[model samples]
Target: MPKIFSLFFLFVLLISCDEDVLPKPKAYLSLEYPKKSYKKLPLKRPYTFNVLKNTTIIDDKNNWLKIKYPTLKASIDITYRPIQNNMKELLTEAEKLVFKHAVKAEQIIPKDFVNTKNRVFGSLYEITGNAASQLQFHVTDSTHHFIKGSLYFYAKPNYDSILPAVAYIKSDILHLIETLEWKKSI
Candidate 1:
C-alpha cells in the first residue's frame, strides 16, 4: 500500500508540472458593419451631401442635423452657419470645439480637404482617446456656407471598444465630404 501511494503521488506531480496559469487578455466585441450605400440627403437645406442609407436624419432648427445610426447608438451632429464675412470666427469656433477634447484625447489629427471645383474646403479632426467626441470637422465655401459636424456615441467613451465603429463612421464622413455641395451661394 505504501509503494502504490508513492507512485500515485509521483504521477500526479509529473502531470501537474505545467506553466503558471495566466488570465486572458481582454476580448473586444466583434462588430460587423453593413456595406456602404449612400443616397442624397432627402431634405431641403442650404447645403447638401450624400448620407449613408442606414442613417436617419433628424432635422433641427437653424438647419442643424443629427445623422443617427440607431444600430450603433451613435450620431453625427451637424450645425450650419452661413458665412457673413465671419469665416475667421467660424473657423476659430470650430477649432475650439475640436480642441476641447484635448484634455482627454491622446492625440488630435487634422486632415485638410480642398475641392476647388466644389468650393468645399475643410478640415477633419480625428481625436484619439476616451474623449466625448471622436471626430470633428468643418467645411465651407469660404464665403457663403459653413458647416461643422461632430461624431458622438451614446455610451460613455471607451476608446478601445469604440474604435472600430469610429473607423466605420469616419469612412462615411469622408464620403459625405467628397459629395458635399451647396445648393446656391448665400
Candidate 2:
C-alpha cells in the first residue's frame, strides 16, 4: 500500500511538471507597421505647381514614408514641381536621376493620363539592374507641374530576393495612386 501511494504521488508530480512546459510561439518572416501618421512639409523648389495633401512629408531628404506589414514593407515618395523650363528637359532630368544607379533602362511604359483643368500628361518607366528592378511613374499637369515617382525593391545581385518585396510594394503604390489629389501650387 505504501509503495503504491508513493508511485501515485510521483505520477502526479510528473504530470504537474509537464503542465508547466508551455509551447513556444512560432517564428515568422514578418513586418509590422504603425497607423498612418502623415505630415506635410515644404519643398525647397518653388517650381512646385501643386502638392498632394496626403502625400506630403516633413523632410525631402527622406522622401518616402515607410510602412511595414507583417510580411512586407513599402514606401511612398511624393514630389511636386511647377512647369518650369522645358517639359522635355525636365523629364530628361528626371530620367537621369532614376537611371543614375541602373546598369540599363529595361523598359518604359505609360502609366496613365493626368487630365486636369489646366494640364495633361502621362507617366512611365521600368528599369532592371543587377541588384533590383524599378517601376517608375512620371506625372505632369503638362503646363507647369510635374511629379515623378518610383518603387524600388531591394534585391540580390541576381535579382531574386526582390520578388517578395516587389510584389507587396506594387500594391502600396497603386493605393497611393488611387488616393492622390492635387493640392494648391507652392
Candidate 2: deviation at residue 180, Å? 2.2
Q: How big is the positional error of residue 29 in model 1, measured in Å on the Cα after superposition?
A: 3.5
List the candidates' TM-scores in order: 0.87, 0.51
The count of backbone overlaps in candidate 2 is 11
What local distance difference test score does each model get? 0.95, 0.52
Q: In candidate 2, where is summed lDDT lowest over 10 consecutive residues?
A: 62-71
Error of 1 at 108 (Å): 0.4
What candidate 2 gets wrong by more than 4 Å, as runs, is 1-58, 61-76, 99-120, 129-133, 153-158
RMSD of each: 3.1, 9.4
Instruction: Give the clashing pairs for model 1.
Output: none
Model 1 misses residue 171 by how many Å? 0.4
Best by lDDT: 1
TM-score of 2: 0.51
Residues 1-186 of candidate 1: C-alpha lDDT, one tens digit per residue: 999999999999888987777899998687899999999999889988999998999989998999999999999999999999899999999999999999999999999999999999999999999999999999999988999999999999999989999999999999999999998832
